[model samples]
Target: MTILVVILALLVGLVGGVLGGQSRGRASRAVLDDSLQREAQAQAERVRSEAEAQGRELRAEALRVREEASRLYQEAEVRQGQAAQQREQAMADAARERADAERERADALRERGETVRERETLKQDRQDTKRERDELKREIERLNRRAEQLDARGEKLDAVEEKLEAHEKRLSEEGTALQERVRSAELKLYEVAALTPEQAKEQILSKLDSELEDEKAIRVRAMQERASADAKRHARHVIAQAIQRSASETSAALSVSVVPIPSDAMKGRIIGREGRNIRAFESLTGVDLIIDDTPEAVILSSFNPVRREVAKHVLEALVQDGRIHPSRIEEMVHKAQDDMKGFIHTQGEEAASSSGVLGVKPGLVQLLGRMYFRSSYGQNVLKHSVQVAHLTGIMAAELGLDVSLARRAGLMHDVGKSIDREIEGTHVDIGVSLGKRFGEPLEVIDAIAHHHDPENGETLYSVLVAAADAISAARPGARREELESYIKRLENLEHIAVSFPGVQSAYAVQAGREVRVLVQPDKVSDAQATLLAREIASRVEQDMEYPGQVQVTVVRESRAVEIAK
Candidate 1:
């Protein structure tokens, strides 16, 4: 039984084995399939991943391309903008060049046209001149013929005049005899009717006096005409000669002199020990010592003319002596100042002789000569006075006025300037007093006084002197220093004006003679502007150096805004 069971079991085992083997095979196959599927899935997943990666790469490349394109577009836009700006600049340059070229062309054309017109005008003028010349020639010929005819008629009239004179004398004798015979017959009845000779003579003399007075007016007019013509001719000749002459530019001598040194070692000696030498100079001579920027020159300044002269001489002497010290400076200054009085007198005399004004009072001449130390408009006052005197004398002689008086008055007009610093009156009044004290006549004194003040002069001569003085002063380039303070004065005026609350800005125009203020519209009303303008004008008058009245203007503005669609 065991054997039979074993056989059956073996068969069952074999079948089971076969079935198990098939199952194993099937499971192995399943395992293999699963592995294949997994591998395939992995491969599919890798393929999908690769595909996705490729797509992503494509997308990235596309994005990079888009970015690059955008960058290129941006670069193009920048280049376009640059080109546009360059083009605009080029266009502007071209337009400016074109405008300049057109203006030049137009100016050239205008100049050509002006030249043409001028040439045409000259041609017309020449034609007119030729026509006038022809007419003059014709008139001259007629005058010559008329002169010859007048000569012939004069000879004939002379013969007739002699014959008529003889005839009249014979007739007068016969008539006289006839009248005597008739008068003898009628004398008995008419002797008492005849008047005396004295009565007839008196009446005739009275008529003659009236006629002489009437003729005096004609003579005066004729004399005036003749004098005017003579003056004009003389003036033209003198002015022409004067203008043709070469004039020396006479520069006034400076009060200061610059001394040059060989080396800088002299500066120490000039300063002396402890600045004593400079102190001595300042104390004795009263001149401020300015030592700067100069190789070896020391500047001397003083308002006192005499003191300045003394200091100059002392410094020169000290420089020459080579013994520069405080004691030496004091000694030299004393000697120099002592010698200055004689110098003043000699200089005054020399100036008078050079000016051809003799017989002047020595004191007055000295005063007059001191004007050399002063200047007006870069011209020495003494020299200018001489020139004015000469001019006045020339004009006076031409006008038949008193030339000597005019010359003396003109020369002494500003004499008081010498002592003006010491005086307490106007230079004009002081000058007049000085002139009168110096034996000047009433006319001369009046001239000196009334030259700048014309209200008091009663004489024609005084009027003429005043006119000449003004002419000399008012000539071009005749005054000193057109003051810059005038500008500040104008600015101050404007500042004072704008100090008001409602005023926006102020401008001083016409050299401070007019003030124009701009006012805020909301702050200042129209009526207020007028009142403010008047008030500003009044204020300027009170605080200004203006010769004439000031005109004030106030401006206000309002603006309206609108939008248009």
Candidate 2:
């Protein structure tokens, strides 16, 4: 730009000089014009060189800009490639996730297949059981036929015995007639011989008396034999008929009930907030909640069957609801208690219907239902009652007594057991009271009061009930005391474990097969805990008797907790 300006100024100067020379000397004018032309040409050459350098500089700047743009384009392409790689990586990640999902699905399907196979195995086992039952039925039928043959033979023997009794009676009659004729002849001889009348009279009287005693003795002996035969035959028939009319299956009850959980992790949830939930549940339900290392299971233990049942329901509900808190525990406990009433009613009704003892008052039925939870010597009281009812009914029908009255008496024989723990009396006393309160017949009440003592039975029906009760109670598997001993042993184990030094708590689980003890970490070291377990186990072995073996576990734990606010 500067060079162009300078060249334009030189043109203007040359034009001015030419105008002035025209008015001056020619030689001066020529010199000035030459000088001016040379200056103009130099200025033009300098302008051209400067412009070319400027052009070169502009071209260099453009080239630099183009190079910068090329670098930017390269960077953009690299970034695009990086983005594509990232996309590929993400796709790979997605594929891996999909693969993991497929694997999980496959595992689930495999587990389902195994479950199906197990289900089929269970079905097959049931079929095998059915087959065994069928075989038992056939055997029973064969025994029945054999019994019929024995009965026929017994009848024949009975007929023969009757005939012999009649023959003996006729023989006694002929002997009596012979003795009378002898007495008459003796009297005549006494008169013909002219013996003293007083002496003959005394001799004849003594002889006749002796002869009469002998005849009476013979008749009494024959009568006793016939009576014995008759009594034995009748008892056998009555017992056989009663037993044949009844069938039952039952097992002893246990003190603890196990509730299944979704997972072991739920143990922590159930023992919430420093075990407030568990403590609340135990207090509300009157049950001991034994949460141990037993996988996916917890035990609710109480000597009271109803309380244990309620605790079981509460725990199951809490687990299914997945909300375990003290308040929720109390709520569930109340709900379970309410449910228990319905359950008890249903059980009572079923017992009545099954035992064929109708017209039981609702209140009486409720009491009967309570007996469902009550057990005597490890026998379920309600079930025992039903079996007794069946036996009594059958026997009463055969013995020409009131069948319904007998059944009712038998079914209610143990009704007092329902409240035996509540009221202050023996079951017999409570039962008699309840029977009267419910308007039971005199025979029924008498049976309930004295089923344990048949000698006190007031009527034939009461006697039959007592007999039936004896039969039902005597049946194999109907009663057991092992349950009580089993629970006692477990309690004894816990007691022993808790007696140890530094032990905080002890729980007997695995049906008294194991005892878990928690010890204070500050008082008991890890080594001490091990020794404590051994000591507890030794104590249990020494002080208690249990089936199988009892495992003792002592846990000493130290926990650190902090609150972040």
Candidate of highest lDDT:
2
What are the TM-scores, per candidate, against the unseen true structure?
0.41, 0.46
Report backbone clashes per prediction.
0, 0
Give the winner by TM-score: 2
Q: Against the true structure, what is every candidate's RMSD? A: 35.2, 36.9
Candidate 1 local lDDT, residue 349: 74
1-565, model 1: which lDDT tens digit per residue? 3344454465556556655665768855654555655665575566566667777887899999999999999999999999999999999999999999999999999999999999999999999999999999999999999999999999999999999999999999999999998878666444464645576568779999999998998999979977985786575553323222212234444556555554667777877789988887788888787787776566777766667778878877877778988778877877886687667677667766654567888888778767767665556667666666666666666677887777777677767776787879977888888987888878778877887766778655566566555545433234444345666677888888998889999998865657889999999999999899878876875677543345788999988999999
Give the alpha carbon lDDT tens digit for every residue of 146-238 in model 2.
999999999999999999999999999999999999989888987898887788788889999999899889889868976975786577678
C-alpha RMSD between model 1 and the true structure? 35.2
Q: Candidate 1: which stretches are off by over 4 Å?
A: 1-257, 474-565
